[model samples]
Target: MSQKNNKKRPKSRSWRGLFRRRSDPHRAYREKYLETLQYQHRTFDVKGLTTQGIFTLELARVFVDLGLGQMGQRPSTDPIPRFAPAQQRERHSIWEYLTSESLQNHNLAVLGAPGSGKTTLLKHLTLTLASPESLPESVQGMPRMPILLLLRDYAAIIEEEPDFSLLTAVKQELARREENIPLDWLAQDLQNGRCLIMLDGLDEVAKPQLRRQVVAWVERQMQLYRNNRFIITSRPFGYRNNPLNGVLVLEVRPFTPEQVRQFIHNWYLANEIKSAGHDDKGVRLDARQGAEDLLVRLRQTPVLLDMSVNPLLLTMIATVHRYRSSLPGRRVELYEEICEVFLGKRHEARGILYDLTPAQKKRVLQPLAYAMMLHKQREISIEEAMAIIDEPLSRVSPHTPRNEFLRMIENTSGLLVEREVGMLGFAHLTFQEYLTAVHVLDQRLEHELVQHI
Candidate 1:
């Protein structure tokens, strides 16, 4: 009996030590979490065409200043009222703005137009929060676990079964990192203001009714888990009023000229690093030269300057300029050329083979674009999208399965992107709007053209 009790004592001590380590939130555990985050996100996760390296540093370097301002008039297609309650605002970096005393207790609603770097900014914050090496002075020594939840994924779950808990999602995510803190312990941590919850893409919830539910869920979470920091991101037109009582609303400012120059330089430097590892030294020199040339052209062209304010568009411009040595002057021409390149030249360079001509591809896409416009939806489920796509596809390739063709398009065309398991949206809202405009032109709706423009 004495020997058995002695054996159990050591085993009990080991078990207790395990719980102790899990309960102790410190720098060592935080380092592990940061490693996991960096691995999961990687630089390829950036929106649009994936830049080759861990360009998080580049993103941070080029990070534009965010400003407070009255919600300006949005595009006609997106008529949702501004959500910010105040008229006065100031510009600040993510580090400076988020670390303020005013925002410590209040949740933040970050609103921007599509392709305006809202998602990228949130992701950069997440990576920074997790990484001790990159921690800004404001967030340094702040022992908080940053959990990023995609609102679309949460909404999909909510739509399937209304009883899904956000805590469950958090638990599953933490489990990925082997940090399975008890639910009650996690809740206590949140209530104690030790967690940073980043809810990304509130606008990505496709249905209005569904989005309202998500908004309500987020509000409930904020209220229930009081004192925790939360940053929720959404497009300008998709945002409604403050769902949380003390939420701070912020808008991502367009990139300024100097910021654009910085981004171009960083972008090429990162690409040069990527090329140096696998390609000839000449490739790196060419990349550097191309970036310098592009910057000069951007300064010379006012239209491109105005368009390049958008990070996504700027990246595309850089990409096109690298290969083609010129940019289209008109917005419509740019989109049209981009579409053709994505369908043909880009795919060819990547060694992907596609049999459909650009015209046939456009024919198949126009119907879906029109459908999205009619529905006023940015994303749709696979079932409905396929149903809408089947007719046009059947006419083009009678024997091909619609699902197979849809996969081909998704795999090849960077324009249409899969957001979640069953949801598909345009890679950027600009693409959707441009395609819709193309459809409208094909229909010769002159009055509607004025309205759309």
Candidate 2:
């Protein structure tokens, strides 16, 4: 009986081992995916593939959990169902241009009117740079992950500088749990010729003076790190030929009506694929119908292309437009309203003040105006703006001193961005426009009132 029991136990143990050895489909897929990525690393001339190493242990876990590598994970059909000829041309042109030797000499400056997908393009470019599959063999040899820094945040940090090294500030930013980025490894990789920086929203930085400083700082850093590249995006108003005078500039043209329709169609298809687990016949038909409607609505303007769906700017526009009627009708008016709001005064009172104190107001508003216009039309330094304003630096304030007028503008709008303690400018092109509108309106009103008197 003991021998029989022992024989049964051995059989049971054998059965258990066999069951454990049976392959897990999901695990096998993950292994294959990782193996493919690893195999690609061999083709690169990388000194050491630390970028892949860090990302494999970090982002891969999250991507796997999200089923990115699963057999049925990607939609059966192309996620983007349609593309216009013009869009194809534009995309191809951009890709070709970036791949050109000019790319090496030029840090990309993407300029577009507001709501023209400038930020989206930058985000897409960053993703492309990060993607293992999309990268060239040479780029794969590099070891650093592309870093996208929002200029507004960077400006804020620089303003609050307490002797912190730039490297330390960058580390804190890269070490977020969501990003799970390895900063030390990244820095080492950068040193090894493996990193790119995508600095977005140059136009969003509130102050013109700070913008110039930021640009100068970036130029200096590029000199320091010859291997790394930068891509900057901004609206045409605040980021023309200022500090980036000699840099490679790419204008983001508004999508043509046909391009707009195609983008809307693509967006609808992507949304449908994301929403539906699989592309059933019904889902395809629904996507087609949605795309048709979206295309029609999006063909009016490049901004409307964004409004056909939810994007950050579209949401802001929708909210603002609901209060007013139409964007075009209210563009200048809304700017004026924003100026009044930023200035903490009613429009009527602001007008009255312009009439009551022309010289004092000109002294205050002109410097701010020149700074805004300079930053908007062309990127100009604060020192240059100061020269234009011709204000004695002593009068611009450091204490409770009476004559410091620019501080008043800074204090009112919270838009004044100081790169260092004493240096300052408006935070964004929108703010610049606001300040510009106030200055222009006040000057016009002062002129009219004087004529009446």
Candidate 3:
């Protein structure tokens, strides 16, 4: 009976084990959590054309190859509504900006246009600080625990439950992927000034009231926890108030020509490694050739090169060009090829019995696009959209399902997006214009152009 009673307790629950864990409870999990975060944030998915058809690549695998970018700090002396830096705002390498005294010294607000890689910039900081394999030479100092939260999620929670605690929101975001991190550990780290909290996309909160709430909550937290470093990102338009205290403001400059060149080269290398699974030497060689050739092609298309400074447009251009590698060097050919890519999205071979042919579907969108242009409307109501698309779709597919067709366009092809809850719009104005031209030309409606004008 004594032997049974004295049987060794599991090592995990032993008194010594309990004391050891208590002595440094947060350290054990915090270190593990940092590694977990590194793994989770290290890879980013890029969706577009690849050698092996539409693919998503780990863009960060080659992030270092492109090098860290610089941010231009907005001096408060600069007048409000002044863009283009009337005076040269001080520039710092993003790595230096984060690791130096600046981050610990003052809260930061980074503003840029949509699609200028604002999220990527914040994420780069997150990935680098969270148990990085190596640090950029420009970076210095000890690592801080990174806590990345989308402000939209918090806004959503608050929109639903306005009284939700900010700490609870952070805890919820941390646990979102079932990370199972202890709330106590997070709170302790935050209190001790060990966390780098990044709140991304003030613009995405969307509703004005919700954005105000988010702004207020952030300000409150900053006031309460002055020790911890914080970073906020948004579009230039979303952050007009300049509400946060002692915040350094910065803007993400457009990618320089050298940056554009390097980013594309590494981007393709990442894609080649991920999609084609080529040998390293072969992959590098192909990636170099592919990137250079793409640049040459883009250079020929002035319209594309003009938008290349934007990382989002640059990525889209790379994706579209890779898919349409054989496009004839003509302006019309570029638009036509783009249309073809949109037409060939997952709808082409869903293997479903009700799948509509890409050509038939394209025709329906073409006329609808034409109608939007005719009305000078950015978006159309769902009911008006059905009325326009139904007759055209019925002409091609007598048994077409109206709701399913709209769903395919919205979800699968991404040709049309829900601009509002019930209003549908072409994904881009260019899409509408190109499709309008196609509709007018193909259907012999050129005469109507003069009448509409």
Q: Give me the displacement of residue 342 in model 2, in angstroms.
A: 15
Name every residue pair that clashes in candidate 1: none
Write candidate 2's Cα lDDT for 1-453 as tens digits: 001111110001121222245463333332332233333332212121111211121111111000011011111111111233443343333445444442444455665433345555544544445454445544333222456666666775665663334456555554442233334544554565445566767766646677777676666666565565566766554464344744556654434445544544444444455467566777768767866744443354444443333222232333343334455444655444334433434212323122212234334544555445644443444565555554423344324232334444443233444434445555455545555656556557445334533
Question: Of the pair 2 and 3, which is ahead by TM-score?
Answer: 3
Positional deviation of 302 in candidate 2, in angstroms? 12
- Model 1 accuracy (lDDT, Cα): 0.62
Ranked candidates, highest lDDT first: 3, 1, 2
Q: Each candidate: what lDDT?
A: 0.62, 0.43, 0.63
- Model 1, 39-97: lDDT tens per residue? 65545333334322333434553444444332344321111112233432344676654
- Preferred candidate (TM-score higher): 1 or 2: 1
Q: Between prediction 1 and prediction 3, which has the larger TM-score?
A: 3
Q: Over 4 Å off in model 2, which ranges?
A: 1-93, 134-144, 160-166, 178-182, 274-277, 297-453
Local accuracy of candidate 3 as per-residue lDDT tens digits, 335-396: 55445545553212222122566677788998899999999998899888888888888898
lDDT of 2 at 210: 73
The prediction achieving the highest TM-score against the true structure is 3
Clashes found in each candidate (C-alpha, N, C closer than 3 A): 0, 9, 0
